[model samples]
Target: MLKGLIFDLDGVLTDSAKFHLAAWNNLAQELGIKLTSAQLDSLRGISRMDSLNLILKYGKQENKYTKTQKEEFAAEKNEKFLEQVETMTPADILPGITELLADAKKAGLKMCIASASKNAPKILSKLGIASQFDQIVNPALLERGKPDPEIYQRAQQLLQLHNDEVISFEDAAAGVAAIKAAHQFAVGIGDKQILKGADYIVKSTKELKLDKIVAVFKRNNKKVG
Candidate 1:
């Protein structure tokens, strides 16, 4: 019985990758670093600090910055990202997300966001869908980020639901890893190969139907049982 749904905000709900990329690129340019497209993709589903470390390492300057300096860089990037976020409107909600939220509400499923972003609430509100979620797990409260189960575990706890009663939607490999690690059903919303660990995969949210997802979850749960 899938009683709850956990969602990753960025790629899953709306495409914030452009905003993130623009911010990272702006910061990289300031530091005289050039990031490849592949490098930008790798930042998905990771914390701000972790992404900064990866960028610094790629630029061969990881050893050059103190923790405080790195924090400043991350903060600078976030300010730029927030500027983009501020421009978001309900029109920015991705395809099928509005339909999915309506369907989930109709089905009486509890919903929450389990994201690496500290800006989850702002993003959701800007998309005009903040009222749909029961909670948005605060990444800052967790000891670990995506690829670790802590964030999802915290979301599940907040939802007051058993892990087996939840299905988590994610767009990144790390997010799928976290969902599975938390003993929940993992529905990946991206390339199947990249999110191979997921119990189910859809190329995009537009393909998601509540009834179909429930059917799949039950079948998979039975097999696991």
Candidate 2:
């Protein structure tokens, strides 16, 4: 039986990924490099420095930037992201998320956030839903980011649940890989093709009902142990 629900923040609970993308795009403009949607998508569930590196690598211009310049550029992008997120409120919570959270809580499941975002706390607070989580695994605290399982492992540890007892929701491939690496059930929350590694894939959070989620998980596993 599932005892915990771990969610990814940017794409799962909110639409802050758009803000991040926009900020990165602004950064790309400043750097005289163009970031395609695919490139931006690849940056999901990674650190700011990793993202900047990916951008640099993609443009084959890593040799052109100094470490300090990279840091400054990341900061410039963050400023724009902060501006967009600062105006967010509860209304910014994605459709069906409020209800899903309430239903999960009522079912006695421990809820936590296992996001790669360093701004998880700030974003959750801006959405007026910071209190919704039992524990939040801050990316700043993790030595490695998603696709590295450490973040989800920390979240499971804090929730006091075994890996198999927790189910994680993610929209990014790296996020799914992390959850899977942690030995937890992974639920994908977007395009099936991109999110194919997930144990289960739901087109949107709106379509993910609590009962159905558990039912699906149970169906896939003969036993949780």
Candidate 3:
């Protein structure tokens, strides 16, 4: 049986990734660093500091900013992101997510969120689902973010569940990689090509089937032990 569900917040629970992209892109433009949409997409699911560093490295703008300057730029991006997110409503919940969460909770599965966003808790609160999760592991508590497995691992530990007892749902490549790195089964939600390594891929959260997720967990458990 699947004992827990670990979710990635931005793209999975809410459609806030676009706001993040906009914030970053706006900052990059102000800094005189031109970033293509493709480059911006690559930064998804990464921490603000890491994303800024990557942008600096790739844009060859590292020499232009001191550590303090970089921090200021990152702060500016987050400010814009928060401003945009202030407009989020319950309607912003991803398709089938409310139903999925309700079903999972009813099925006796513990739920948690493992996200790179520092504002995850607030977002959940705003959505009126803050109390739904048993735990929430976000960037604020971690030294690193997605693709590093720290946040996911922290969530697993907090939930007191083994890897086999839980499944991760993610939409970004970095999130999928982190879940897999932590030796957990991952359900990807988004472009199939980018989510090729996911144990299963669904076009949206609406496509998620609880029975199928549980069955996969059972099958994996049997194979492992």
Cα lDDT computed for each candidate against the true fold = 0.91, 0.88, 0.88
Which residue segments of model 1 deviate by more than 4 Å?
none
Per residue, candidate 3 scores C-alpha lDDT tens digits across 153-196 of: 89999899988889999998999999999999999999999999
* Model 2 ranges with Cα > 4 A deviation: 223-225
* lDDT of candidate 1 over 64-149, digit per residue (tens): 99999999999999999999999999988889889999999999999999988899999998999999999899998888878999
TM-score of each: 0.97, 0.96, 0.96
Encode model 2's per-residue lDDT on 18-117: one tens digit a residue: 9998888778877788888899789887788888888888888888988998899888888898999899898888888999999988989999988877
Best by TM-score: 1
Residue runs of model 3 more than 4 Å from their true location after superposition? none
Between candidates 1 and 3, the TM-score winner: 1
- For each candidate, C-alpha RMSD in Å? 1.0, 1.3, 1.2
